[model samples]
Target: KHRWAMYIDVSKCYGCYACVAACAAENNVPIGVFRTWIERHVTKGGTVIFVPKQCNHCENAPCVKACPTGATYKRTEDGLVLVNDDLCIGCGACIQACPYGARFFNPVKGVVDKCTFCEHRIYQGKLPACVETCPTGARVFGDLNDPESPVSQLVKKMPTSRLKEWTGAEPMIFYRDLPSEADL
Candidate 1:
């Protein structure tokens, strides 16, 4: 079984927003909402840091538990946090539960929506939209179970950090060389 994970090398990112555009286009994301977005932080020393934000696909997802209708759930096979449009009630519980602010109610569909790591494309042997369009190759995706996978190898070599680690969601997105402080 392949456990999917994403590794981001922040040092390689240049805040081009190419990944953001690519993700929106590929996912058909609506305006005023983002399946993936980038946050720019300027340190005290004036160095700019770009932190790309998306669904963490948490191992202990609060959104999954908060969804009253069981619309939000994590896949046991690959740990992808997915929304079932049929089951969603637009209650906004998932949105409120998510600390990462990665989900939203799609008014067009009357259901909650969020990032799935482009699992459809992954099944077709393609990278996620964000990863594919990253000009600097800052994004990496692979099976964490595979020792030779880039994500796995990066975790071994890099000092990685996850967003809100104290919350214990066990976020699968790992960042290398990330700024210690992230601003919205």
Candidate 2:
């Protein structure tokens, strides 16, 4: 009954790329590809902000619907969108369907891969590598269904935005303190 979610304080991110490096090491992501990455945006007024990007783990994920096989799925328990390597054909259908550009074909695994919010670590009662490694504490993760959880509290208290809301993917990743001028 847990709906896991992440809240990113965009203003806190300092473009250190620690989260990016942690994600790559923890997830074994190949070179030249990333499960999570950072985007640096400068406003017209000359303010810079770093936005961390990854799978939104949408409630209505287009990647799940686009999969020819049942490789891509959303876990009902925690709302984690995942890929089953055994079922994956690397057809790239899911990649094309994702408006966020979160998926990629893994040459090492020969299957589609993406961020799972570090499900393996989370189930072990640990934070996602990105969240744990973030020097500025920009990322917060927890069960959104829990009223007392940090993620839920932040979402309730702050003005937040999700990317590509027009696509209706219902992305779970929320951005706090996102500047309006920063191009998403």
Candidate 3:
């Protein structure tokens, strides 16, 4: 089965906002709202860390199930949960359902907006804008179903984890070398 996943190596991140700006420009994400954002985490050892944040594309997506207008749905081909703008009612229910606070209301479009995993670029067999523009190659995207993929290999070779695992969202994104202060 084809599946979607993103692996971020925190050790490689250097507080570069490349991923943030790239995603915004590619997706046309509105101003004053971010589809994704990066947080700076500082630990007791005086070690500062950069953590990129975005939707987890949960297996049991509460955002998808909570949309009253049937706007949010998961792609069967790649498992990227997306919103249908035309069908969206701007109820903002999904925004609350997301534990990571990844969803936001777009004042310009008058609907809820969240990450689409760059479906536009992915459909062209190209990487997401953020992943493509990452200078450090910190963000890795691939079909996690393929054991040979770099993301799969990293998952196998390292102790990685996702956010809010107790929520049972079954997040597809993984993080490695995360400092305890980040706790993502």
Candidate 4:
């Protein structure tokens, strides 16, 4: 089984919003919301850091549990958390349950929506728009279950962190070289 995952090298990010734009264009995300976005943080010493934020596609996703209509679910095969629009009631339960604030109520669709790690493209053997558009090569996406995958190798060899670890959501998105002072 393929376990899809992403590795973000914080040290390589330069605050470019190419990922953001690509995600919007690829997913047809509404004007005011995003599936993936970049956050700019400055430490006390005034050093700027860019952190990319998106759905972690957690192993224990709160959004999956929170959806009353069974619209949100985690796919066991690839471990991708996805929303079933036909089942979605646009109740915003998943939005509130997401610790990473990755889910959004799509005004256009009237349903909760978020990153699918570009599932359509991935299954077609293409990279996610965010990963492909990243000029800095900061984002790496692959099957974590594959020993030879880049994501697997990076996680094995690099120091990494996931957001809101205490929540026990078991987020799959990993950040390499994340500064301690970035305030999550």
Candidate 5:
């Protein structure tokens, strides 16, 4: 069983929006909806910080709880939160339940949509498009079950925090050197 996780070094992000563009293209995300996005935080001192936001793929996902049907669920094998489009009722509960504001109702598909860590590519032994295209290598993905994985190794050495940690969703996305202002 591969417990997957992502490591994002906030210091490395350049706010190029390359990851954002790549994710949208790879996932075929409809216009006005995004599977991944970058948030810019500008301090009064003129310092700018870029934080990449996406589905946390939470361990105790509120979206899964909010769904009237079992459309939103987490994969036990990889710990990835996923949606069953056929089971979706187009209800906005999942979207509202998400504290990170990562879920969206895709008008084109008539179902709730969000990031899946690009599992389509992961299962094929390829990295997610966003991770592959990031020029600064800010984002890293790996199986946390493997101690030798880069994400695991980095996490052991870095001071990592999850977005909205107080929510107790147990988000799998870990951040290093994140700015104080960036919450999600």
Candidate 6:
């Protein structure tokens, strides 16, 4: 499987939100339900900062294993997490099962919705909308398994983190910056 990874350089990101808009427009993500979203971990006495986040597509993905139906699955070839809309029952079990809160139930589609790493764009050998449109050049995407990929190089060069490391999800998304508490 291709090692998929996203690197977010927090230092470069200044909460501009171009990535958020791009994800919404490119994927037609619903208003209330987002395939990709941001989580601002504010800290340092109201000194707020933003971190754009989405599915990490973990190696041990709970969202996939918890689906009572065979709707959520990871592609063994590309390391992409996908939800089979046809197989989804809208049970919402996978929604709660996700440690990252990445899964959203789409009432219109009657299935779970989350970032598919821009599968449509990936198929065309294009960057994910979020990464491509980030005006600050904060987001980088590549195959982590490939040692020479840009993502892998950045990860090796900087300090990075994934949320909820204790859960052991092995999230592929990485953050180079984070907010300090007290701003919260």
Worst 10 residues of 3 by lDDT: 175-184
Can you tell me which runs of candidate 1 are displaced by over 4 Å? none
Alpha carbon lDDT of residue 45, candidate 4?
A: 78
Better of 1 and 5 by TM-score: 5
Compute the lDDT for candidate 3: 0.87
Report the error of model 6 at residue 169, Å.
Answer: 0.9
Candidate 3: where is the Cα deviation over 4 Å? none
lDDT of 3 by residue, 1-184 (tens): 6787899988898988988899889988887899778899887899888998898899988888888888999888779899898999888889989888999999888888888888788768899888999999999998889999888888889899888788888888999987767765
lDDT of each: 0.88, 0.92, 0.87, 0.92, 0.92, 0.82
| Residue 66 CA displacement from its true place in model 6, Å | 0.6
Name the runs in model 6 displaced over 4 angstroms.
180-184
Model 1 per-residue lDDT tens digits across residues 54-126: 9988999999999888878899988898998888878998899998999987777778899999999999999
The TM-scores, one per candidate, come to 0.96, 0.97, 0.94, 0.97, 0.97, 0.92
- Model 2 regions lying over 4 Å from their true place: 181-183
The true-versus-predicted C-alpha distance at residue 134 of model 2, in Å, is 0.4
| Candidate 5 structure quality by residue, lDDT tens digits, 1-184 | 9988999998899899999899989999998999999999985567898999899899999999999899999988889999999999998999999999999989889888999999999999999999999999999999899999999999988899999989999999999987778974
